[model samples]
Target: MRWFWIDHFVEFETGRTAAAVKNVSLAEEHLHDHFLGFAVMPSSLVIEGLAQTGGLLVGEHYQFNERVVLAKVSRASFHFMARPGDSLTYQATMQDINENGAMVAGTSHMGDRLQAEIDLVFAHLPSRENDERELFDPADFLAMLRLLRLYDVGRQSDGSPLTIPAHLLQAEQAMEAATDLN
Candidate 1:
């Protein structure tokens, strides 16, 4: 699956909140089909981006063990259009978290302008019990976590690196080297 949102974590507080950003560019292919003449980022994908950012935050809380998927979005709204050349910063705060699920609230801003806001709910499922193992794997999973820079910031509430496994790190380096060649 292509990652629709490639995020950079600016700050993360274990079980509390996280801030991230996505740089929208004209070079993206979807812009061509999203609109004929006036390209704009679709609202659905904007929500997806928010979901992705929030999902990672929620998932990390479980140490990548519990599978968390976006279960619902409530009162989601958009105020402005996001187009190429816009750098959208997304900030998500966890409202609640339990064994069953998590609730998060987020806002997307293009510079100082509010672009969108959402209240998202995510459900946690055990990986062993999940039927979509092919869709999620330890390798790609860790890569995504690294790509989001989830482990590159402050320690968790208990003071830990939120470490990524060594094997995953090696795999990520290989992937990065391969991409660099292209």
Candidate 2:
């Protein structure tokens, strides 16, 4: 969670597919040190962007109740390096999801050109909290979703605005209260 590769989610469907975007810019520090005088978005960060898209798509099915983690990368291939000013769009489709884990196929594109394709595996871990808080605080997660404009524009398959679950809203309210006290 230290770095967010994706800038925002352009499309989100509960358990099916999601699309997100990331714009490579000259302002990013990592781009500078990656290679002296030659800046390109790192392949690893591109993979992470795809993983985030896939992981969120899979996790939404459980209502964010499970701790989802990237378990493995079955395959990842990039056709070309992305340079500054390039906008990358990532798409992930769910292959199959069950109680234990899920598999997803993701692809990235710069305009009409394919930049990368990835086959990923994700695992659901036993729930664990940090500092008496959930592994990922629902409030923080919701905030992230808001920042990504997911809730503002996300829609269900039937074309209804995606509503925030009651449990998550309650958790967010509690978090706000806790923060108020400190």
| Candidate achieving the largest TM-score | 2
lDDT of 1 at 64: 59
Per-residue lDDT over 54-84 for candidate 2, one digit per residue giving the tens place of the 0 to 100 score = 9988888787777789999999999999999
Show pairs that collide, candidate 2. Answer: none
Residue 77's lDDT within candidate 2 is 96
Q: In order, what lDDT does every prediction score?
A: 0.80, 0.89
Q: How would you encode candidate 1's per-residue C-alpha lDDT over 117-171 as one tens digit per residue?
A: 9999999875565465534656676766767788887357777766665656676
lDDT of 2 at 76: 97
Query: Candidate 2 local accuracy as lDDT?
Result: 0.89
When summed lDDT is taken over every stretch of 10 residues in candidate 2, the lowest stretch is: 126-135
lDDT of 1: 0.80
TM-score of each: 0.82, 0.91
- Overlapping backbone residue pairs in candidate 1 total 0
Q: Residue 29 CA error for candidate 2 (Å)?
A: 0.5
